[model samples]
Target: MLSAGPTPKVPLDSWEFVITTETGAEYRWSWSELMALPQETPRVDIHCVTRWSKLGTTWQGVSLDTLLDGIDTDAAYVLAHSYGGYTTNLPLDDLRGGRAWVAHTFEGGDLPAEHGGPARLLVPHLYFWKSAKWVRGLRLLSADQPGFWETAGYHDYGDPWREQRYQGD
Candidate 1:
């Protein structure tokens, strides 16, 4: 697994996932609460910007649609925040309609910390970097805000199929 920095170990008991709207309103879910939500096993092919591809990987987790249900917001963008201060941005639409999930299990087993154990954002359609590891929350924004990689010259919309890796790609 590729990481921008060292892996972080987050305890499950204190783990929490939050979604904050542009209006400052916050929605939260503890580990137990998250686990109780409806879960789905998605088998997808993931591609990395570095030219590596992993096909037919299975993951179990709550769908972003399920987690975002009942939320009221007009934001058009989202910034995913992770436990180790890692962040990534995506169009809000990309996260809905079963396009994404907060994955916690891989291949029928608990996800290891090095692989974003407790939870990670899974956006298989895009390059792997768009899937923020150790995801802690999502911040809704009215305007696009570059995250860790985006700010450093990575493409704002990292579509692997189109080879959108660097800013000019």
Candidate 2:
């Protein structure tokens, strides 16, 4: 797990998202697009691979449970589209388990962009990389897939409680 350091603050009004693939493929997303997604409020603990664990982060944004609604995702895994085309993939079930969220606000305030502002996936159970920043969209896959650091041998689940950081798990 790597720490990008204390996240810089960016107002939600200034936050922007561009969903892209490893090959520079992209789809621009507007704040309104996110606002349109069904919203939910949840209590979460964020574990950064950098080792900063922020407990009880109250967030507001689209719930993975709702964002994926009606989408026929046959893939067994999911890849999160991110800035710089940096990406990470995880088990689809983990995403759909009703614990994931596209969080925009933290502690009732807008999340800073450095913290993956506008919106970022909050997978509290996994190491931070599994929780990609500047999240744009989700890519479904049929097998265990790796992304960015995962290709560099990072763990798949990244569960902090169990210390799933590298591939030896």
- Candidate 2 all-Cα RMSD: 4.0
- TM-scores for all candidates: the values are 0.99, 0.80
- Best of the candidates, TM-score: 1
Q: Against the true structure, candidate 2 has what lDDT?
A: 0.73
Largest lDDT belongs to which candidate? 1
lDDT of 1 by residue, 19-98 (tens): 99999999999999999999999999999998999999999999999988999999999999999999999999999989
- Alpha carbon lDDT of each predicted model: 0.95, 0.73
Off by over 4 Å in 1: none
| lDDT value, residue 86 of candidate 2 | 66
Q: Give the CA lDDT, 0 to 100, for residue 159 in model 1.
A: 93
Candidate 2 — which residues are off by over 4 angstroms?
1-29
